[model samples]
Target: MCHTSGVSSERAAHLLRLSALFQAAPAADVQALAELARLRTLRRGDVLFHQGDAATHLYVVESGWLKVSKLAAHGQREVVLHLSGPRQMVSGVSVFVDNARYSASAAALEDAGVLTLSAEAVRHQTAQSPALAQAVIAHFAKRHVELLERFDDLLFSDLNARLARLLLEHAPPGTTLLLPTNSELAAHLNTVPELVSRKLGEFYRQGFISLERRTVRIVDEAALRSLGGP
Candidate 1:
């Protein structure tokens, strides 16, 4: 991890504006936050923060991707919770909670740039700005709805349907898509890598997809769409 002071006020403000939680914030509050923000760079695979770490700062991705994950209760497996890209937040929502710690670990999926802001400063600003508080509430409401949808999928959908949906999300018909490794996919799908590989092989044999290295090419969109369902 490396920190740089070169993030200009304009860039910082722009990044903040992109976040739904801060997009409606008062200009003065935004400016104040811009001044308090710093840029941090991460190498691929670098751990940004471990689960249970003090939530001292909120992170906003400026470029590349970050993976949010948590280990299983037995401590023998990890589950990928979310993947955040540019303009997305990693710990912004969690930082506002009293005596908060990160609920999950965050790591770089690729070389990335992130903006960091003091959680204390954000709390102070929110206290002084009603508009900021309203924005935070709206952000949480939206996140809640999304979580509900994900819960429904996990509860009702089978692994094959989930895998199909994942592939279709990343690739359109006849287009090759670069993907994370099998282990990463399994982690995201809440399955074992062997099962993921087996599913891919089945899809290949069925003429639904083709795999080369870490890339997959869709061969039968209709079949996958049917298998994946609505």
Candidate 2:
């Protein structure tokens, strides 16, 4: 199980310095915002929220991981998004829009520490502070752009490319890949378990990747990229 630790004073201070999301806010305002947030812990596989459920708060992870996914009609799950490690916020877009129902569900991938701020509270604070308002707007804009990029990938990319990109993006730096269950990897890549299994076998035989139980290591990134084709 992944363990989540409370935000240390140094980390909290560092988060306030982030420029993209809260650039317009002054350092003092950022610090105040941090203070207003409440921290919570989550364990791996724990559901943070469910689809169609009321969206009340935005969460910022202090540590660990979360997967944001949607459930299909056939009882299949698709991972639509991933979230921050330390000092990164999750589901900011949904909360900022004042949407009552969540578009997706979030589950802890590991033990995670998060700070949650009620939408009402955030709105109130932003109302009195122009900096906070700018921050929220930036957050919304970023999420919109990210979703558009994902849409492009879904429309134009093949399954192998999609899976490779997901692995490279989420895996630890310098790590070739992670061996996740076919179902889990399929969900993230927007594919089916059977197809994923077949592709994995093909890649393994081609010397593009090495598979051990549930762990996958990329042996040839160039070869994997070739499978995506130009």
Candidate 3:
């Protein structure tokens, strides 16, 4: 279940202060949006909003993680696009575009807390605040670059290279990290779970990494880096 409630302006502004998106925004403008902010709490597996839903509110993650993904046109497949964590936008960029619907759905990856600001309220303030407007433009540009990078990775990078890069990103050499399941990994990699499992097994057999259940420790960082590329 999800719960929603109004939040104190101070609390909301404090959350905004923690995000780079609002860091350079004027204090008065931040307070204005903060006054309209609400708190939303979600349990693990709860859907924050569906794709194609009206983008009424912009969300900022306060705690835990959420998976932002899109379903295929036939509704038969899902591609995990991004993992949003604390202080990051959750289905937020879309809110800035006029008449935009959410292009992807967001679901809590774990018990999570999110701050919600009404889209109408935000746009109203944005028009009067050049600093806020500039910050939002920067944020959108950053996301656009990330989307292009992901497209490049998917189009040109082979699975071995992609998977190796993914592992290294989550757990650098000499560090052990609990990893998401193969299914989740597959969704992020835009592949099937069986293939993910097979590739992981191959990596283990090659002594590139040590796997204890889902926990992975890098044993050969040089080899993975070479395969993963720069």
Candidate 4:
């Protein structure tokens, strides 16, 4: 179940700090932006917005996880773009560009807190604050570069290499990563679930990784790094 709620000053400011859009701004500015934002509680599977939906606000994940994805044409499949956790913005450039519409869809991966900033509010606040403006630009640039990297992988690399890279970058030596389900991983990798399962099994056989219920433990970082090489 989901609901909207508010928090006290200390907690609200803390939540804002988690977001890259406000992480480095002055305390006063973050507070000002927080004042204008409304808190939302998202239940697991809550659809925050859909591709082609009118761009109304920017959302920050204060807690829990959010999945960002794009549906394929003919509606036969989807490609996961991101799996965002705490302090991350469901940041899209739509609000800043012409005839704004989200290019991808986002949903709550679990119950979470989100802070929404209306486009108009941000425009006004940012007009009066250069710091906020610069932070926004930086955030946009980061997200844009990530998109470009995803494109490069999809266009130039093979599926096994992409999967290896995904696990390698996200998990460190001997660390167990809380991974998305096979299906979600497939979508993110722009492949099928069977391929993901098979490749993971191969990784296990190679002594490069170990898998359990919802977790993947890195066993050999060097081997994965080799397969994940740029």
Report the alpha-carbon TM-score of model 4 versus the true structure: 0.82
- RMSD for all candidates, in order, please: 3.3, 3.8, 3.3, 2.8
Between which residue pairs do clashes occur in model 2? 179-215, 179-216
Across 1-230, the per-residue lDDT of candidate 4 in tens digits comes to: 56766666666677888777777777888887778777888888888888989888878788777889898898788888878777777854676664588999988876778878777776777788888788878877887798798899898899878988888756666555677778998888888899998999899888889888767888988887788776
Between 2 and 4, whose lDDT is larger?
A: 4
Query: In candidate 1, where is summed lDDT lowest over 10 consecutive residues?
Result: 170-179
In angstroms, the error of model 4 at 209 is 3.9
Which candidate, 1 or 2, would have the higher lDDT against the true structure? 1
Name the regions of candidate 1 deviating beyond 4 angstroms.
164-178, 198-212, 215-230
Error of 3 at 48 (Å): 0.4
User: Per-residue lDDT tens digits of candidate 2, residues 1-230?
Assistant: 33334555445545545534665576776776666666678887788888888888877766666777777777564665554455566766666566567888888766777777676766667788887787778767887898898888888898888776665555543553334567776766777899989988988898877777755677777775666554
Candidate 2 overall lDDT versus native: 0.69
TM-score of each: 0.82, 0.75, 0.81, 0.82
Estimate, for each residue in 2-118, the C-alpha lDDT of model 3 and write its tens digit: 999988999999999888688778999999889889999999889999999999999999987788889887999888887777788776677778889999999987788999988
Clashes of 3: 0
lDDT of prediction 1: 0.85
Clashing pairs in 1: none
